[model samples]
Target: MRALALASLLFFSAPPPAAAVAPPRDAYPDVARAYWVELDGKPLWAGQPDKRLPMASLAKLMTALLIAENADLAAKVTISRGAQQETGSRLGLRSGDTARAGDLLTATLVRSANDACRALADWRGGDQPRFVAMMNARAAKLGLRNTHFADACGHDAPTQYSSVRDLALLARAAMKQRAIVDAARLPSFRFRSGAGREYRMNNTNALIGRYEGARGLKTGYTPGAGRCLIALADREGHEVLAVLLHAPERWWDSIGLLELAFDEAKRRSRR
Candidate 1:
C-alpha cells in the first residue's frame, strides 16, 4: 500500500506538458507565413509570431502614429518633388500641391497612399531617412525587438522586417490615437487639397464593409511580402485583433481567425 501511494505521488508531481502557443501546423496550413491573434488584449493564438518577415505597407502604422504625435493636423504641407516621385500606390500628388497634414494622414491610413505618407514623413522628419530613424527608435521604445523600418512608406527592402507579434503591439499603439482609429475605420474618405483638387479614396481594407463587426485597420502587398493585413473587430464589447503576414487569401483567413478569436474569448468567459 505504501509503494502504491508513492507511485501516485510521483505521477501527480510531474509537470504537465507545455501549453501550445498555437494549434498544430496542419490546423492552419498555408494560412500565412506568420500570424497572431489577440482578444481584448490577451493572446489568443499565434503561429511563428516572432519570425522576421516583410511587413509591406503595414509599416505606415508607425508613420501615422508619429504624425499624430508630433505634427499639427491643421498645418498645411506642401507636396515636395520627392514625395510626388514616390512609386507604388499614390494619390497623384504633384509638386507644389498642398494639403493639410491631417488629410494626408487619412489618405495614408485609409488608402495606403505612398505619396501622402511620404509627404507627411517629409513634413515631420525633414526627410524620409530621418523619419525612418524615428520609426526604429520608437520601435525600440515600444519593446518591439523584432521590428525594423527602412522606409517611411513600408517599401520592400532587404533590411525592413517585422513580426506579427510586434505589429499587434504597434496596432495597439496606433489605435490609441483617436484620429488614427477614426481614419482606419472609414469605408471611404473625401478631402480637397489646398490647390482645390478634390479627391476620393476608398478604404483598401475590404473587411470594413463586408465582415461583421469588422473595423478599419490596414492591408498590404508586394511581390516579396505577398499579402499582409492587420484586422480589428468589435462585437458586443469584445474586440479582436489579428495580424497576418504573407497570406495569399488574407481576407478569408482574417475573417476566420477573427471568428476564432471571438469564439475563444467566449469560451474563456464561460470558464
Candidate 2:
C-alpha cells in the first residue's frame, strides 16, 4: 500500500515535459528562422533576432519612411527610365508617366510595387546610387547597425540585408506616419496615372483585413530571403509588433506570434 501511494505521488508531482505544452509565444519553430515580438514597446520574446538576413520587399518600409520625413509628398515625380524599367513587381508606370510622391508611396506600401518604390527613391535621391547612399545614411542615423539597403525597393542583393530586431525599429518609425499606416491598411486602391491609365493595386499582406486587430505593415519574399513579414496588431489597447524572417509559413507564423504575444501581455498584466 505504501509503495502504491509513493508511485502515485511521483507520477502526479512530476513536471510535464516541455514539448507537452505549447511553445513559448507559440513560436513557429519549424519555419520562423528568426523573430522578434514586442508588446507596448517592451520586448516579450525573440529567436536570434539580430541575425542579419535579406529583407526582400521589407526594404520599401525604410524607403517610405525616408521619403515621408525628408520630401514633400505632393511633389510631382516624372517617371524616369530607371523607375519604369525596373524588374519585378511594378505599378506598370510608363517611362513618361507622372505621379505625386504620395501616390507612389501608397503603391509601394500597399502593393509592394518595385517601380513605385524606385520612383519615390529617384524623386527623393535624384538617382539610384545617390538614393542607396541616402538609405545607408538614414540607417546610420536610425542606429540600425545591422541594416543596409542595396536598393530603395527590396531586391535580393549581396549587400542588402536587415535583422528582425533592426526591422522592428524601422517599422516602429514607419508606423508613426499616419499615411503609411493608412496605405498599409487600405484594402485596395485604384491608382490612375497622370497618363490617364488606370492601375488597380491590392494589399499583398494577408493580415491587412483578414486578421482581427491587425494593423498596417509589410510582407516580403524572394528565393534567397524565403518569406518575411513585419506585422502590427492592437488588441484591446495592447499593441504588439512582430518581425518574422525566412518563414516558410510566414502568414500563419506571424498570426500565431501576434496572437500569442497579446495573450502573454494580458496574462502578465493580470498578474
Candidate 3:
C-alpha cells in the first residue's frame, strides 16, 4: 500500500509530457486561433483545431491541387487582363504573358504569387469565379465542412475560411502531388519568360530553410486571418504535419510544435 501510494505521488508530480511544446502561446496571443499536430495516422496535439478562420495563401494549396489534377505543367496559359491585375503579391506577368502552366505553378506555390494563381485559375476553369466554385466542390468531396475558397490565391474575403483540421487534410493531399511537393519545398525558383525576362521567387514560408527536416505546405497572412502555416517534415519512416492559424509567431510556434511531435513519435516507436 505504501509503495503504491508513493508511485502515485511521483506520477502525479511528474513534469508535463515532453511532446507538449508549450509555445509561448500567450506572447503571441492573437496570432493563432487554432493549431494541430499529427503523426503517422494519429493526432498528437491540438488547440481549437476545428475552429474556422481566414486562411490566406494557405488556400493556394487547393488551387495547386486543382491545377495539378486538370492540367500539365508544360501546358501554356495566356495571362488575361484580369489575371494581370490581381491584387497582392505578383509574378509581374504582363497582360499577355504566355507562360507554361508549370512555370506559373512554381510562382504560385513558391512565392504565393496572386497573379500567377489567377492565370492558372483562368486556364483551368475559364474564369476565376468558376475556378473558385471548383475549389468549393473539391473541398466538399474531401469532407471538409469548414473550408471554402472565394479566390484561388487566398485573398481576404468575407466568405473564405478553413479550420486547421481541414487545412491539414489539404496539406497532406497537396504534398502527395508531385508538383506541389517540389515547389513548396524549394527555397527559390527563377521563372524565365518567352521574352527572356526573368523573375526570381523567394519562398514565403520562413520555416522551409530554417527548420531541420521541414519540407513544406504553405504560409498565409492577412489582418483578418493573422498568420497561417501548414508545415510538413519526414524523418526515417515517420511524417509530421503541423498547422498554425492566426499566429503571429508562427515560425517559432511551428518549429516548437514539430520538434515536440517528432520526439513524441520517436518515443511511441520505442513503445
User: Model 2: which ten-residue window has the lowest total lDDT?
Assistant: 15-24
Name the lDDT value of residue 242 in candidate 3: 80
lDDT of 3 by residue, 1-271 (tens): 2334433432333324434554312222232578777877466666776788899999999999999877888987888888889988887888876888998998898899999999999989999899999999999988898898898888889999999889988877787789889888999999777666788988998878887777887888777888788888887788888888887667766766666667767776787
Off by over 4 Å in 1: 1-29
Error of 1 at 80 (Å): 1.2
Between candidates 1 and 3, the TM-score winner? 1
Model 2 C-alpha lDDT per residue in residues 117-197, reported as the tens digit of each score: 998888888898899999899889889989999978998999999998899999988989878988888878876778888
Residue 129's C-alpha lDDT in candidate 1? 85
Tell me the TM-score of each prediction against the true structure: 0.90, 0.89, 0.88
Clashing pairs in 3: 31-246, 31-247, 31-248, 32-246, 32-247
The sequence of per-residue lDDT tens digits that candidate 1 reaches over residues 101-142 is 999999999999999999999889999989899999999999
Query: Candidate 3: which stretches are off by over 4 Å?
Result: 1-31
lDDT of 2 at 255: 69
